[model samples]
Target: MKTYFALIFSLFIAATAFAQNDTTQKIVEGRKNSPDQEKKPYVILISADGFRYDYAEKYKATHLLALSSSGVSASSMIPSYPSVTFPNHYTLVTGLYPSHTGLVNNSFFDRNLKESYSMGNKTKVADPKWYGGTPLWVLAEQQHLLAASFYWVASEAPIKDTRPTYYYIYNDKISIHNRIEAVVAWLKLPAESRPHFITFYLPQVDHAGHLYGPDAPETEKQVHFVDSAVYELTKAVTTTGLNVNYVFVSDHGMTKIDREHTISKPAAIDTSKFIVSGDDILVQLYAKDRKDIQETYQQLKKEAVDYKVYLKENMPTNLHYGTSDDWHNRIGDILLIPNWPKVFNMYGRKQLNPGTHGFDPYAVMDMHATFYAWGPAFKSHLKIPEFQNVNIYPLITAILGLNYTEKIDGTKQLAQEVLK
Candidate 1:
């Protein structure tokens, strides 16, 4: 009898020790989610670049559509002015307008650095140092949470002491499969170190759309490619038995433009009079000689019959551009916006080939973007009436429980709409 009793007590003690250790591990790893975490809340922000909302429905992305049918969905998302990828992505992460985030264009003169910064140059890319605002990933790290990014806006750039725990260098050529692989690798890490926040970017949809129109069959197929990748990623994450959340978003919608639709300065103006900055819909004209401002302005105005020409002081206030000192100097003295299909690039002898963005965001062809949410954290079967790309930042920060108090131009939060 005594021996049997001893064995039973020993087993009980061992089981208690194991349970205690498990609880301690959960706390140490920061995975001890609250009672409210039953939804298996985790976030995966996926960027499909120039995907349009209607295509998402028309093509019947069963997986993505299920997310909308089960969780919150939006008919369309509005993009900020000069809606290029860099600016729009920055806005998504920082909750700031292009002017506030200092990414007004993909390629712009950084007066402070006395050098031009562009999306192509990794060295000159925007970072926490140059950005006046904080990205959600930085905030996540500050809160002792592990954040990983496969490929996201400015993820490669070193931010003030806060870098994603894991990140891949931004590559325009990286296939959808590789991006999914990288994300799965990070999630499969030791449970204690698994990322609490993850961001994945698929550039093919946007890349192909820029070369073709967003509605082109090629672009639609590209969207399907990304959709397939997302479906696979979701399955992988769920199989790991970790609670996760997913967000599908695009930087901006796309528009079709060709050479026949292009406009430029009349042949009479001296070609060498100004430095030409290439923005498809918006033209930035820098005077080669400051003394010619008045004459150049008059000449540009005379030829600007097809587009809207605005002096720096008289620029549209609603566009949320041109008011800041940094923006004023970086932008040309005169800004020109073209009508749809009608676009403009710096008019030199060089032949311009290809479609582009950086147009007004409210045009009939430009107003709508795409957004979708899935997993347990989102509000089920809800539709958000109106939202912007900048609203994404607040949603990310809130989901990660990061402490950020900076005043971003975009303060709206989608948590209530997306979270049950």
Candidate 2:
């Protein structure tokens, strides 16, 4: 009886330890902002995933619209090609296109790593090796400026051997009130330990978008949810008297797909000859045999319907994807980007979710995401034209007064246009 009780207690303790790991924030020890760095301005970069470009006006996201109108608002922000959640969010911070960043898709096979990266896989999500480029948080930390994340893609991973000084592993269990409280606490920290750069993410809009089509009332409800929550967030922070800068954006927009007319996985694909990753909107096939690439590309092209097939080298150059820009070689050998509203039902489900994104933003307006900014760092009442998401990296670095000379796809033009 005693032995059994001891074993049960040990198992319980181990389980409790595992659960506790993700439920709280992780702070890096022995890190502090320099006196000069601590004096830098504060920025809370917020992403409401899948919040469409027109959502503020269309859905009446009042706080966001009003805030942006007071500062700067863009017509729309063009997401990197194949606009999707993971790649574009990473792009927003790194100033690199998806192909160059080694995060080519939400789920993609890395040829060199000989492995797959999927958002669902916790182990891969936390692995530093899978991430490339110096994310904004990492850049700030290296320069001795503290950073924090309420949540953002890859913020958990210690890319470049550094993560935000204060961050929590992704968890939906925490309530909005708790999250807001945490940020308030961080702002109240002693100057040396306070964070000047922070990332905040809200997933409710994206969740509703994927489950209920963008046009559905459920999605609208979530949009309102986001609007309310952000209002609360800003209001709470206002008490801190820090004059924090705010830049609100999203990874991609949501589009309703024709579920009744979904495409099937091409019969031409032979699993033995390739490894397939990615989803319906953008299908990526990683070739097992180098010689197999061209042959498969031709075969896919011949049978293609409602989709455009391309050899990786032949993808549209304007996308900044494929051969030359594929510096990390993570893009697949063949690509299949389907026409809008005609998604590939690869998993053989009865149908796909009513709404999804990952289309070329230029071709489908719905693929365009949001961009709005206010607070001390920006010019007031300015509206700019559509710009690529990659430019966000430099815009942020410029605001924080952090310097970098690394060649990135984004231009300094955006900073010149909007900054005060």
Q: Rate the local accuracy (lDDT) of all candidates.
A: 0.70, 0.91
Candidate 2 structure quality by residue, lDDT tens digits, 9-47: 999788655644576889999999999997899999999
Segments in model 1 whose C-alpha atoms lie over 4 Å from true places:
1-41, 126-129, 172-175, 266-273, 287-291, 324-329, 345-355
Alpha carbon deviation, residue 204, candidate 1 (Å)? 1.4
* Candidate 1: residue 350 lDDT (0-100): 52
Clashes of each: 4, 0
Model 2: clashing residue pairs?
Answer: none
TM-score against native, each model: 0.83, 0.95
Summarize candidate 1's per-residue lDDT along 294-406 as a digit string, tens digits. 77677767777667776666777777777453442566666678877677644442555455566676764554678888777677888877677778887777776666788
Worst 10 residues of 1 by lDDT: 20-29
